[model samples]
Target: MSNYKFILSGGGTGGHIYPAIAIANELKHRFPDAEFLFVGAEDRMEMEKVPQAGYKIEGLWISGIQRKLTLKNLMFPFKLISSIWKAKKIIKSFKPDVAIGTGGYASGPLLKAAAGKGISCVLQEQNSFPGITNKWLAKEVRKIFVAYDNLERFFPADKIEKTGNPVRQDLLEIADKKEAGIKFFNLDENRKTLFVMGGSLGARRINQLVEKELNFFKENNVQLIWQCGKLYYEEYKKYESDLVKVNAFINDMKLAYAAADIIISRAGAISVSELAIVGKPTIFIPSPNVSEDHQTKNAMAVVNKDAAVLLRENELDEKFENEFLTLWNSEEKREMLGSNFKKLALPNATKDIVDAIEKLLKKAA
Candidate 1:
């Protein structure tokens, strides 16, 4: 019998946090008695989210180096060194069998400590263009799980495993979308349903554009399941009507994905992966706020392949309506986009990542 103990690290954003949790859940299902710990940035979303996901998480006093010269950048070295020391203590006391990183600033230090202690460590990168943290951690980590291909440029060739991003299990198979999802949102099944999501915290520019164009949706006979995000919901909620179902946060993503004939979303790697799996015709409005402009790169990875539409945030106001009208009216185009996108969905990512982790653990044992 093998015992499994894991230290999973990732955070700052749901893109990073959710993947770590999905991997943790997979490990738990396979090894029910396995012990798990999560490490995230001291004040990041993960600090709250990981616990909410039913895991104990420790916070490291760490922050990313600011792009511009500031006092915060001066603190980087101290934060990094201290975080590394703290992470080492966490690892030593916890005595985990393996450490997994899902690519966040905190994961860099946590995974580094685990690897320094000669523990099995796997790092998962969600983007086609790897983030600097994951790229830096790749050299030390034993395995690299990637959602996009051609990652050998970032990680060791031998360590790279092209496991698609693990999506929520419920999202894997969407059952009775029109009935279940439409009813959940109390939406009209007879009309074309457009699902708009700007990600968990929400995208300001996208929300604004949606607000600017809300009337166009009504003019076009489209019903909407709009997630305006917590920040913008209050400002945008007043615009909601029978044609629009607006919410600050959406808990039932599977239902949302199921109810949509078309989707408007931020092109985060995980969102892209889910859209690909759901095989929906999507318009990706990549947020410019992310590091390395990775969201645009992520959108291009699919848009270039004709799997989804790419609408730059800057151009969204002018082009969103035209693009929406085009995709909505063209059934053949929608099917083609969905077909190409579906081809990219790696449904077995969770299983594959767990298998890789188990292999590394067995070898180490």
Candidate 2:
């Protein structure tokens, strides 16, 4: 009988939360007796999301350092010290067999505490460019799971494993794209469909650009599946039409991905990973609002490889309609982009990451 207690930590966004959950779920499947605990930043989305996933979680009074020197920056040292102390208490009380961090603000302190206790710890980094938190955790971590190649520049060569990002299991299978997807959205088969998602809370800049351009699709006999996300739903819902479907959230993203002839989305790490798996012609409108301009870097990874097209958020008003129309008119170019993206798909990422964790667990034993 396998006996293991696991402590998983990651948060701040769905990119961090989902990968941690994916790894936790995979761990539970292989070790039914395992006890799982999630640690996240206090009052963050993960505090709500992790519980809904049927896992117990703890929170730290931790937030990311501000870009500018402010009062929040002054509190950073205090928060870090408090979070480490809290993490140590949690780790000691739980006596976990191993700790895994999926990369977020809370993860740094949690993994640091775990490693200091001489507990085996692993970290999963989703971005092509490693985040500051993961880069700092690189030395203490026993194993590192990565989504992109050439990560050896950021991490130790021996510790890095190119496991790809673990996306939701449901997204792996693209079944009956025409009938299932069209039926789900009540969309017409005669028109070409575009799926636009700008992340869960929605990108205000993307929403503004889409609001301006929705009528163009109506005139051109094209259709749209627009997930405006929760934040901008009310403002954009009035623009919905027979050809232009507006949603606050898409519960079945696989269906949305299947139905889309083309996709417009934010280029967050998780979104890029899912797009690679979905293998659709995607125009990535990278948000300038994020830290380190990571979205632009994420999009460029695909655009440089001919797997996607990139439009900066600042330049959306100028370029979105023209570039989107150019792609819409050319089916051959769309197919080329989709095919090239499929080459980067790592469908077995979840299994690969779980395998890495198990290897460490065995070594610790």
Candidate 3:
């Protein structure tokens, strides 16, 4: 009954990958004898990151079907068939007590195969607007853990649980990281620092917005730690100065959160969750390009609560300066935003999720 084996399938982006790792870490802490195997897309970020988290992982030859009809889309049927077979083989050999999916392309085939074989399967959806993969797997999963309300619109009402998304352990205790973070970034102790991140690959629109607003940061007496993303580093690196630190990608996000007085970011689900935890005054510019307008829905959840400010991509040019100035000029508003936003944070999410997973494990036992 002990020494349980588990399969965690999710990846393609940090949003999906980190939650899976967070769940795995909590399970490992609670049951050191447990064995874990992660399945992710062969050439994606999870293939690299899962190993770095000190776990064994296997990659499936899978990729998501594109929106438009193309060669990749045409190959979807074959890719899916190949992946399902590979996933079945992995599940058979692993014989997991439970299978947990955090929502990604790989999770679709793997979880479907697990559920087919009568394994306990659960899903953790980080976005307010669930992705296509999670939606497709909704009927098959025994339980679905979600971050936002009103998910019954898409999921089975009885099976849905409102546990917030799991965050990495390093992000949980940031009260003491401020001084270390300031030192780490070589930021001026006297100046207000603004941290800007657009996810892992970087946000092109956000980066363009930042580029145009460099002088505005100067006028407000703000210093910046801007993660312009790897795609735009060459384009934006020329703007870095004593007052600005430009990064292609940031590995040390805990410190990045600690060093910032204010944050400007995209409204991806994981970013929103972490920002709530960091409890910093933030302005979210949700990406318009995302499916189902997912970022906007995620950002609106916080904004509607008066916990944070949100600006659509279209509104940035007309309203960005004024919205930012309103926050910057008023210390009370900054504190209010940070404090109210913190009210929405669920710091114990990882523990809660693991507890539920343990219940599913007992059922299978």
Candidate 4:
């Protein structure tokens, strides 16, 4: 087999970056000699993250249009033009067999340029409500791989494939690591463990909720494994103790998931996808400060199925305690939620997405 060159673009946040890395990792596994190049917005997280994942990446001068009118808005057109030009040059020089986008500012121009060059393109939409970038690229791309059902409302029905978001592979074997997880965190196995994650940077409101409820958790004999995120680690680090383990980030998420009996998290698309596989009873506090309020919609997909609970940021003060107590007090309720959530897990999502990409490449050949 000939060595295939692939271009993957996604950035701005972990949600988009991680999925792109997951897909790239899977493709590298299948095509060991394949050359991979990642394109991401200059100064964005992916520029840093992609390299850490051990892939070569080039940065594009790109950013999203700000919702508010500002000097940044005036620069949007310039950035778009520059990014597309750079994307075309990259495509021409690299001569990739396929271009895959996980959806971010850089992807809009990169995939558009790749498709214009007659290179096959694939998009992975991690949310039920597709982003503007993915929606725009839908017409040109060869296939749209999605994590949610009924996305035909956004993309062409013929092009859509319901493949769940790619998550860390280590999370797949969490059940077998329970003892190791408990020991790693040095937590009491006899007590229930509540895991709190706010995303890569962390959620301020979620951290506050945990801070406010620390005494309640201790009184109830519950142990906490809190990922306070980088931003708030200094403020929250003082609370770390035997019953509560606070971290800026959990490097081994598999161990964290294994230790968690219950989880409180923000409903970012990738987080929800990983949680579904973790199969823990979870309460989602979706961030309101997102595009199209997509986080709420992401949470509702599982909540509507009775597979998880949704606690809006605004509702946290009024509803968090009662909602949390309801779950904490009942093992039966927790089991039901965990079981239903597990049913939604797409364990082979990475493989399935690669399968679709291979078919497209075969057709091209």
Candidate 5:
């Protein structure tokens, strides 16, 4: 096997960062002698997270441009040019065999520069709708690994592959980790565990809803593992008790998934994909703040499959309690939802994505 040098770019959130890290980890396992570098937005979560994942990273002076024409839009060109110039320098120095992007504004300049240098490039699109960066780079990259269907309208039909998003492989073992998970989170094995995920920064609306419903949960005798995210940690950490374990972020999702009898989550692409693999009955509260309202679409995709329940922000007051109660009371309903969700999981997504990268490397060679 060739000792390849790889550059993976993407990150502003855990959604993009974790996929790139997962792909890099898989590539490292396959090519032990390989070298890896990550390019993400400056001072963003990726700078801190990529290093934590045991990889080197370079930060670009870029973030997403506003949809509307504004002063912020004026700054985009300068940021883009600066990022492109820096990306070229990184490419010239590293001379990577291949470049991979996992769909974020951070990847745009880096992948564009890498492609311009004739370095083989591949991309991963996590949402049902494509991000602006991936859509712009679609024509240049060798392949696009997508998680949703009907992406052919936005990407080249020949280059797009439905391999799903690369997720932490440890999730596959969640079934057997229930006992260990119960111990790890210090929860009573007798009480049903409810795992609440609001992303790396946490969801404000979801946090409020969870807080308001604490009395209801107590009445139901449910224990919780709540990942309120860094931004809201201080605001909500005071609610922690013997039955309620609150965290700023969850470092070990495998155990968290194992501990969940039912899950409440924001429907970011990576979180949705991970939930599908965890095969737990889930309630999706997708953020309306995302571009194109894609989080709602992501939740609807699973809901359309009868694999999860969705409560829109506007409807949560009227619908959340009824929906939660219906699913919570019915063992049969939970089983059906979990079973259907698991059916949508692509367990080999990471390996298959790495396989595509290997093929690209071979062709470049």
Candidate 6:
């Protein structure tokens, strides 16, 4: 196993990239000497993120096709050809025992090339709605790891593994860190804390909603830990004070989860997974900008279970106050939502997905 090589590819967003890194980290832990390489889109966040995570990475000239016609769409063919060629070169030289994809533009070419060279491939689909890349690679991959059930509708039923998405390992112990969390955020333990977050880039609508409701929060004596995201931090930072802490990003997310009494967030798949483990009452304002309205679908899964509240971006203004007040004022409702959400958590998701990969490695051996 020491001599074995593994290639992992995913990018474009932290949702895709973090899962790939988590899987890679778990594999590295198990086979301490195993070599790992990452493949990501050249100009995408993963090119910087993967290296920051202490893994060597190669970049491919790849981009997704736009829904509407554009000049970049015209460059897609050349990029695809170049990416596939580079992917083939990487696979041939690295000779990985298995290639794993977490669903992004870069993964398509890399996994396809690995499969073409008789290498076993695995894919991790983070959303209930599979992305185009994972759906395209499903037919040839050895195993398809997914966070949600019913993905068989998109991929071959036999190859699908219902392993939940991997989250930051530190979040698993958030329950024990409440005191530290309060200290870390410098928030009053006596006051209810509302944690607000968009994704890394921030949500324009969510930020606006928070801004509009700042007075409401103050009136109710609720402390706010707002993660406005890097994109909108400057505009929102003026609201920060003793009771209102604003951040461009929350690096100590585990503590943020621990301190949060209620969460107002976008319902990306990874965010949903983390919140399930956090077991706090939550209101999901799903982003409508996503493909196929998947973020809404992701939030609906928990909403349908009565484990969380889903307030669509369009409905936020009309409905957010009622929803937030109801949850904040009722201890029983909050407790029930938290309990139901905890039931949905897969604490061993990273381990389970890695176990699936190990099984494939064993079969190959």
CA-lDDT, candidates in order: 0.88, 0.90, 0.92, 0.93, 0.91, 0.92
Please, what are the lDDT tens digits per residue for candidate 2 over residues 227-340? Answer: 998999998899887888999998888999999999999999999999999889999988888888888888898888999999887787778778988899999999999999
lDDT order of candidates, top first: 4, 6, 3, 5, 2, 1
Which candidate comes out best when scored by lDDT?
4
**For all the candidates, what are their Cα RMSDs to the real structure?**
1.4, 1.1, 1.6, 1.0, 1.8, 1.1
The positional error of residue 199 in candidate 1, measured at the CA in angstroms, is: 1.7
The TM-score measured for candidate 5 stands at 0.94
Where is the poorest 10-residue window by lDDT in model 5? Answer: 356-365
Q: What is the TM-score of each candidate against the true structure?
A: 0.96, 0.98, 0.95, 0.98, 0.94, 0.98
Candidate 3: residue 207 lDDT (0-100): 94
The lDDT of model 3 is 0.92
Q: Which consecutive 10 residues in model 4 have the weakest lDDT in total?
A: 312-321
Pick by lDDT: 2 or 6, better one: 6
Comparing 3 and 4 on lDDT, the stronger one? 4
Per-residue CA lDDT of model 6 for 216-251, tens digit only, reads 999999899999999999998999899999999988
Candidate 5 per-residue C-alpha lDDT over 1-365 given as tens digits, one digit per residue, 9 for 90 to 100: 65899999989877888889989988998999999999999989899999999999988999788989998799999999999999999999999999999988789999999999988999999999888899999989899999988889899999999999888777888888999999999999988999998977789999999999999999988899999999999999999999999999988989999988999998999888989999999999989988999999899999999999999999988888889989989999999999999999987899999988887777766
Runs in model 3 with CA error above 4 Å? none
Tens digit of lDDT per residue, candidate 1, span 1-365? Answer: 34678999998888999999999998999898889999999989999999998999999999998999999999999999999999999999999999999988899999899989988888888999998899888789888989887888778899888999988777767845668898999888788899999876678887878787877888899898889889888788897788988889998899999999999998888888888889989998888887889999999989888899998877876777788888999999999999999999998898899999988877877
Look at candidate 4 and give me any clashing residue pairs: none
lDDT of 4 by residue, 1-365 (tens): 64999999988998999999999998999999999999999999888899999999999998999999999999999999999999999999999999999999999999999999999999999998999999999999989999988898889999998989999888888889989999999999999899999876889999999999999898889899999999999999999899999999989999999989999999999999999999999999999999999999999999989999998888878988889999999999999999999999998999999999998888888
Please give the distance, in angstroms, between residue 144's alpha carbon in candidate 6 and its true position after superposition.
Answer: 0.6
